[model samples]
Target: MKRPLLTRLLALAAGSLLLSACISQPGPAPRATGDLGLVIERASGSVQLIESTGQSSLARIEGLGDLSHASVVFSRDERYAYVFGRDGGLTKIDLLEQRIDKRVIQGGNSIGGAISQDGRLIAVGNYEPGGVKVFDAQSLELVADIPSTALPDGSRNSRVVGVIDAPGQRFLFALFDTAEIWIADFSQGDTPQITRFEQIGKQPYDDLLTPEGRYYIAGLFGEDGMALLDLWYPERGVQRILDGYGRGQQALPVYKMPHLEGWAIAGNKAFVPAIGQHRVLVMDTERWQQQHAIEVAGQPVFVMARPDARQIWVNFAYPDNHRVQVLDSETYEILADLEPGPGVLHMEFTPRGEQLWLSVRDANEIQVWDPYRLELIKRLPADSPSGIFFTSRAHKTGL
Candidate 1:
């Protein structure tokens, strides 16, 4: 049902492929498995694809650099995968064949990467050039390039902080260092128009696009909390929701930079990791208020919730927690503290949320955990890895 719209919307809005372009086959597809497990080996510089249903190797990619950042987008027809590389690289990794199709330049300049929902657009945030680029989903052709730097001065253009695709791919929300935000539409290549938002509160680094796609929730650096930008009235600009909770304070390591050190959004809550205080803060999305601070280990580095919204998963970037922590969503209580990888920062669960995949930044490996039981199932090697995302269809939530 999401089809082309969701992916296209996200491709333009956020500079990330937020594609939900998975297919279930024609008349009758096989019973979907619990999850498609991927373990990125930091040392070997390879990716291992594991099927929980006990199938043979779906595919394995051999040549990749340190493997700093990774995200997968299945084609709208479920034929190929557009792989976005992070930490300065670009290319598409075939999910089924487990091979490199081609190296995509992605606008010549690059910052961070994201895929369109239908896997048709690949978005990139270019830091030095200070702009965002969106590529055609199928051809990988440059469709639009949006510059975010403000000419506050002639020579210097500030960095573009964050990008989020709008629902249905109508527009893109871009944050910049000039304290300005702009909206870019995919329907036309006409120059994008910019609106300077009055800085009412802390400038945010990373942000979440509301499900309604009307407001963008951002975590600020100097302030103790998040800010909400009202998209309902574009000219009206940002609305302050600076409710100081445990993690939004600028002193935290994650807050050290204004963008997403870690952020995730679910039904009614937003999960953020505050490395400075070693905790995960729960925010009420409706009220934009801090509901509670869920204490996590080693300065919560990243927080992600399962599709079911039943459990919240967290990992510490440093050796502080030595294990991944799982919490019950409603009660905000610890369900399990399972050790999986070293220097754990980013992770993803199978579509069913039954298994956990971790990026062992320091360990040169990825640790796979059975989330239900909080136990380690395997440790696969990943070379110089930074982040991880799952591509197999088992994780789709129909929502």
Candidate 2:
């Protein structure tokens, strides 16, 4: 039928309005990921996506294999979290979408992982079958397989520990059974240039890199000292420091190994957990010499410093795990002794050290504290929480 021009224009306008109404509906709100983080639920093999700003859990992602001793590293954008599970499961999670983006079982048992400087590679350190596996950060495909040194008996590979990323696309780790430190340089390509430092110590339990990535220090379990490697001058090899700090005294029973990653450096002094002892070893960072051994509540498991380096927080092993002592960095005095709850497993500070997040496994809670005020601000419930990792670690070295 031939319609009038005014009638045809009105019909077309009505159709346009209908289409616009159907397609232009509002969607979900967009949010930034800078304040986002994850908390590891050790027993359930899951992680809770948490936002630091609101200090609440946004979502829970499950089906991660085993998380008994899980740890996480974030992509450069902080939008993805790479969780290394104790069952050797490497799961890449999409923080914004709140889902597992990819998963791979790369080893028999895994300890931890780290992301490359360019955020392209993800490396996992395996405890069983012993070695490290590097994967493509986006695809979760194997990129490189670095087998740890063979054992003294040539039976199996040595267990790898303390895998951390360095500047220049290099990854550093220690061989537990072989007492060695290795640097895998990948700046060139897929095949890494290996730099091995043998006999660094007896049983290099764990390692840590300086804030600027200048030095790599590995703590020894079979001895009283530690091994230090100056990354700036690799030709000089590893040097032994703090030799015989134990003074050949009968060592106390160690309930748990002290985590070297929790080492604290405040100004010129470095506070390290003295294994099997109830004292925190304060060392002069310049000479790497022991300055003081401040007595603490128990065998210090984690001696961590606040971001401002004003105070240090020390957590203990079992039996005394309920107590956490705060120490003044300058005065080296015990400022506060807090008994938050039983089974305090891990602690993490906010980006600027505004709030401290602690995982109380026995209480099944994540307690947020105002470090300066020394007060508990909030608590979020979880299922056997062990590690509280924040996105701020994405920008830091050796987190």
Top TM-score hit:
2
TM-score of each: 0.76, 0.95
For model 2, the local distance difference test gives 0.93
- Clash tally, candidates in order: 29, 0
Report how far residue 362 has shifted in candidate 2, in Å.
Answer: 0.8
- Give me the overall lDDT of model 1: 0.59
lDDT of 2 by residue, 128-151 (tens): 889999999999999999999888
The segments of candidate 2 whose C-alpha lies over 4 angstroms from its true place after superposition are 1-25, 248-250
The list of candidate 1 runs beyond 4 A from truth reads: 1-52, 55-58, 62-66, 69-72, 86-88, 107-109, 117-119, 171-173, 188-203, 211-214, 232-235, 246-267, 392-399
**Per-model root-mean-square deviation over C-alphas:** 13.4, 1.8
For all candidates in order, the CA lDDT equals 0.59, 0.93
**What is candidate 1's lDDT per residue for 68-93, written digit by digit as tens?**
44444455444455554444345655
